[model samples]
Every structure is written in structure tokens, then in C-alpha cells.
Target: MTSAPPHQSILDKPFVLDLFAGPGGLDVAGHRLGIPSLGLEWDRSACLTRYAAGLDTLHADVSAIRRESFESLPPEINVLAGGPPCQTYSVAGTGTGREALEEVKKFIERLMAGDSDEEIDKELRKLSDPRTALVLEPLRYAIQATRSPNRGHRPYDVIVLEQVPAVEALWVRYAEVLQKVGLPDGTRYEVVVDVLATETYGVPQTRSRAVLIARREGLGTPSLPEPTHRAYEAKEWNRRNGDSAAPVAQPTLCDASVPGPSPAADDDLEHWTSMGDALAEPVGTQHRGRRTPFLVRSNYGSSGIPGRRGVRTDRQPATTVTGRISRFVVFEHLDDDIVYEGARFSMNEAGMLQSFPPDYPWSGTAKAQQVGNAVPPLFGAHLLSAALGLPAPAPEVMREPWIPATEEQRAKLRSHGCGTADDCTARCPRPEDQTPPRSTSRPRRNTASRQ
Candidate 1:
């Protein structure tokens, strides 16, 4: 395993303090980058996974933790990175996006006005929101850490945060506040926030997150890193940003594991990896010289939410793999000897799609929850690289490009007995298992697919 560059002591290296550190995503990436780090998390299942992964962690709620309680620093640099709990600010939450933004503003205004916890709590309770205020905890620590040592402070030299896209408003507001907290020498924080896609940084699946990066006044600067792989075609106006991501297509699910012609022989190959690549196994149907990719969570349930076709092929990058991925169905191709074809993704396969090591040594009863909640470690490395203004090397999990199986090899497999489509419906939680087609009258729940 690669370690951090030559630093005299752990103290000489800027340590990363990860808050709300679900499953050590940032911490694991920090280690890969040779950076020393520790995580602060409250979930027992996630904490167990962290210990299993050999990551340093403190199992406690951020709301109750104190930066002053940490060990004394050696007067070098340090980093504060985390994704505060954001369910209340997510589209999945009961609170409206506008309401969440207002709540954040109120929290800051109250903090600036020196309000008591009880007073703040009373107003938050009136808003019927409790978790919305947690975003402030990191700010509290950032301010505390960057204070002058004469004030007994352990001010962090950098701050990195992430949340759902809806919380971008909250993060922008935060930069406005964090810039004010300074050391005794009047060195203020430098901050930047951007919405970044995981795929743009080379993760197989596509997931967009709002990222915030900051540094001490003297640090060079805070800027989001340039994309490594290509992003899906940008909108008509987004083209002006000039990110200049690779002209090559974004990696597909197959890049992680697939049997195909060597790409070196042809320069115009698709870069996107496929689920089959990550799973490192064949689920395709056999017919003549062709083998069709396997389908997971494809439309084959008794019922489900509409517009969620869940019909991606093993040859394509899997859609955002979520925490509930365990419950999704796999529509096995109707090959010879398999009349009622179907299967579910093993926890390992799902985790791999999320860019985790194959044998992560997961230690949690809620395995799916742990996998879904944490950031993909590869993507986490990208985030850290952006904050540190360095390159995030591609993960070593990728195998060499392959040559497609010859016809003789393909003939050994079962034949595809049925046509291409799987007519069955998926099972949804609602009483009626049937998902009705979208009506022209009722508008879409969202304008764009949250790709």
C-alpha cells in the first residue's frame, strides 16, 4: 500500500479531521494520498465498518464533540473535512429547499447575534426542523481550530465539506461566514464551493455533490480540480465554464472489469466502465458469437416508482448506486436453461460499483446502509486532491483491457431463449405494486434526472 510522502512525524503532516465521517470515505482516501487522518462519526454500523477498514475513528455525535478536547497540535498545518448530515436538506427530506436555506441563514444570524442554544432550539422547533441546524457544527470547529494558540486554539489550516445539491445554497452562505474567522494575526480563510460530478473525476457511476474547499490565508488558494474523464454533454449554457474535461467519453461500468478487444489497438474506445467489469464475472446471455450484458434492478417487479426503469445493462455504468441497493432486483437475461431468469446484486458487487475495494472487510449489520451513505473512496480521493491542489491518481482496481471471447468460447455458454425485453414489474413499498405511466396532466417530480 502507498503511504504519505516523507514527513518527519505524524505532526509534521497536516492531519485530516473528518466529521460526520460515515464509513471513512474521506479518511480512506486521505491514507491513499499518504495523509494522516481521523474520523468523527456517530453511527454504530459505520463506526464498525471504519474499524474493520483499519481507519482511525472516534464514535461520537458532532453536536456533542469539542475541538478543544483534541490532542495538542505541533504548530504545523491541519485539515477539517466532512459531509455534515444532510437528509433534512435533501430532496428526499420533508423540508422544502427554500425552507432549508432559510433555516441555515437563521442559524448564522442567531450565532452572529450570540443567541443561546435554548433560544435557537425553540425557533428551529417552530420550523419543524431539527437536523437542519447541524450544518453549523463544522463551522464551529473550523473557527475554534483556527484561533490563536494563545487563545488555546487548534485552528485547522483547511476546511472541506460536501452535501446534496439542494444544500449548495447553505454552503455558499457558509463561505460568507467562515471567511470572517481569523487567527490572532488576522489571516482569514479562503473558500470556494462547486457542484462536482463523481464521474467527472473517473468514478464509473455518476453522482453530483456540492463540494466546499477552504484554506488558511497563506495557502496558495482554494479551487475545484479540473475533470479527468469527460462529463455527459453539458447543457446549452454550461459550455462557457471551459472545464475542458477529456474529449474521451466518461468511463463506463465495463472499465473496472470486462472481456473485450484491447483498447490500445484502437484509440477511439469507450472509456466508461460497466457493471460486469466491477463484478469481474459474466452474467451475459450466449447466442452465436455474442454475449449480452446482465441487467440488475431492471424493470421486473410487481410494482415500483415510475421513471425509475432500473434497466441499466452490465455493459453500461450503473446509475447512482444508493444505500437501498440491496433491495433492487436483477433481471437475468432469458438464456437457454434459464426460463425465469432473475438475480440480485451481492453486497460485494454493489460496493464495487461504488468504487470500494473488493474485500473491504465490512463490519456492520446494516451493510447496504454503510455502502450507500459513504462517498465512493475514489471520488473522495478526487475531492481531497482538489482541496490539496494535487493529482488524484487513478485507482489500481482496473484490470488490463481484454479481447472479446471468440465464437468457440461463446458457444460453450447457454443460448438466449427469449427476446430482449423483461416484462415483469419491480416491487415498490406502496400498497399497490403497480407503477402507473406518467400522466401528461401531472408534471414530472423534477425537471432533470438527478444524474
Candidate 2:
């Protein structure tokens, strides 16, 4: 896969149609790249948030929408993107999607065999969980674009899909089917699929997702985005500490004397973005004068141990942000003593950690779930740039504050009782007047037995 020439714009006047779009993550990225995007989502809350953010949206189910529905749109939809609902495939949920994998593969095979949509839908109705069938919606859309006469016999120039890591096998099957799809001019799609670590793309969290990118061979090749930052590695002391060992605390941001772990050998890549780096700044009046050296305790256990909970210092990348993020607790720490109990991360902070603009307007119900489920806009930008063979966006683009594009959008936000576009007030706890007791002794090094 050779890179497109610098002078040529592969995505000139491109338009993206995103399925299962949640709160406009990829849409935000598209906006940053000067590309137009429209999202098709059924969730009312998500749709409300999308409208408030000034993104074009089709409030409908992915399965119900067909190619003909988009023919009336002003822009030609050449880019197909989606991140399907992954509840059934998630390890934290029921393993129904994993069990139904074989059936899903069989469905894909039938689709490849030119089976009618009615026949496929009839079989899909028999599944115990209907959501499992939604994963194949992207493939169905691709088939419609390529085979439908109403679309001028033109296939989507690009297709990108993301899901939980367990869905990598399904993406592989998608790659196979996409490669077999031949265009009128004897061209097919070039495909690539892999599990990408969020931190590797500069997201201040340790989350992984299976991603697939396919481009028409006639246009150019498709490739996964290269990592722009090093993967986060827990300090050796933290990693080796067992449940029986004393909890290990990271050095505070104020303590410059204690050095951090060495940088990666690759000088080209930047160090992984840490939770401290993301939250160090005050967002409006909230999170002001926060106590240094805080620890985040996970609500879930590690390695099936009942009492063993995972913990991380602000200096490290955060654990996977999930729908249950409200349950995670943050506490101010001074070596071994808990100095002050702090509030959990606010919706704004959670969105920031997921690489959304700190002040991006978020509305409707289950706001935490919306932020947790979104693809980090920065990560999406890089992925889209790579998939389109365009130059990666500048680093500063992620930090820029989002502004309403028109007076209508501003009016909508005001009607919804939202604050100024720059308002990023989080619900983080403020530091109290009482001072924490100072430690008389030096902090002990980790010398506990690994066994």
C-alpha cells in the first residue's frame, strides 16, 4: 500500500455516513478534517446530543435504513463508518455474541452467496439476542452500495468499522467478503483489520478495539493508522504487587525528585498520555486546586479475585472507561495514608479522557455511558486520515475547544440550558480548608515477595 501523492486530495469533498453513531465521535473528527458527516442513530439520548452538537443526524435504526433513503441527500455518501453495539460481545456482559459467532459467520457466507435480505432477516429473527445481528449491518450496507442500481453502481470509496476485541474474528470475515466485492470496472477493495490499543493512538486510557478499514482498490490502498504514542506500561512495582502486599502508590506530580520510568527506545513516538497530564489543568471553576497524588480505585476486581481490586495512580493511563464509570472512586493520597476522599470523574472529565474536547456539549440520559462508548475523536481522526491516505492531523487539533458552527446550533444549546461553548465545569471535588498531615518518614520502596 503506497501513500497517496501529497498534492492529490483523496477525500476531496467527501461525505461520511456513520451507522450506530454514538454522540458523534467520528463526526467530530470529520468536522476537524473539513469533511461533512451525517450519523444514523436510534437512541433518543444520543440523537439529542448529536443535534445539540450541530451534527447532521438521521434518527433511525441502521437495519431499517436502506441506500435509497440516502439518495435524496445533497452530498454523495462515499464513506461508510460505524462502531456497532458490542454489549453481547463484551467480556463484562453475557457471552452470547461469542456463542453466536458461528451462526453470524454462516450469515456472512449466505450474504456472500447473494442471499436476499428477506431471507437473511428471517434467519436473524431467530437469534436469542437481536442485537447480535446488528454487527452484520455494515456488510449489508456495503453490498447495497455496490449492487444497487439506484446508487449509480458506485461502491463506497471507503468503509471503516470498530467493535470490541472479541469481534476481531468477525472483522476478518468482513475483510474476506469485502475483498471479493468486485466493482463494475474490475476493481475490488483492499482490506486491513486489527485490534488497536487506544493509548497507542494518544488516548489517555487503556482500551482496545477491533477495527477494520477497506478502500476501493481503484482509489488507493487501505491501512490501519500507525501508533503516534508509546503503549502505557505499569511500573514494575505496581505490576509485581500481589493482593497480600501493601498497596503501591505512584510518586506525586509535585515530587520531581523521584524519576518516572524510562522513555521508549523509539524516539519518533511520544510518551503515552497519562491521566495526570489530561486532568492537570482546571476545567472552568471545577477541578480547581485539586490535591496532588490521587489514586483511582476500580469498581471491578482483577483476575477473578473477590477482594482484589485494580488501582492506578494519576501518573498512569486510566483503565478502560466503561458505562459503569460512575462507580470508580478517586482518593487523595500521601504515601500510605489516604489524605482526602475525592469525587469520581465528572462527565466532562470522562469525555476528555476519551479524547473528546473538554467542553464538547453532552446532553440527554446516560451521559457517562455515551462518553465511555465513543471512539476518541483524536484517535478517529488519525484512523480516518490513514484510511484515506491523507496526512495525519496536527497534535494541537485535539486540544482546541469546540465551537458551535451556526446561530441555530447556539440557539439549540441555549434552549437546552447549556452554558457557553467554553464552559467545561466538571463535578470534581474541591480541596477543603483542612491541611493533610505530613509524613515524618520516607516512603518505603516495594520489596514485597512476588509470590
Most accurate candidate by lDDT: 2
- Which prediction has the highest TM-score against the true structure? 2
Predicted structure 2, TM vs. truth: 0.83
Stretches of candidate 2 above 4 Å error? 1-3, 6-8, 67-75, 147-150, 181-187, 235-260, 283-291, 334-338, 404-407, 410-451
Worst-scoring 10-residue span by lDDT in model 1: 414-423
Worst 10 residues of 2 by lDDT: 425-434
lDDT of 1 by residue, 309-394 (tens): 44444544566776778876554435433423345666656666777755565666788877777787778887777777666545
lDDT for predicted candidate 1 compared with the true structure: 0.59
**Colliding pairs, model 2:** none
Off by over 4 Å in 1: 1-12, 67-77, 96-98, 109-127, 147-154, 180-187, 233-270, 281-292, 298-308, 334-341, 397-451
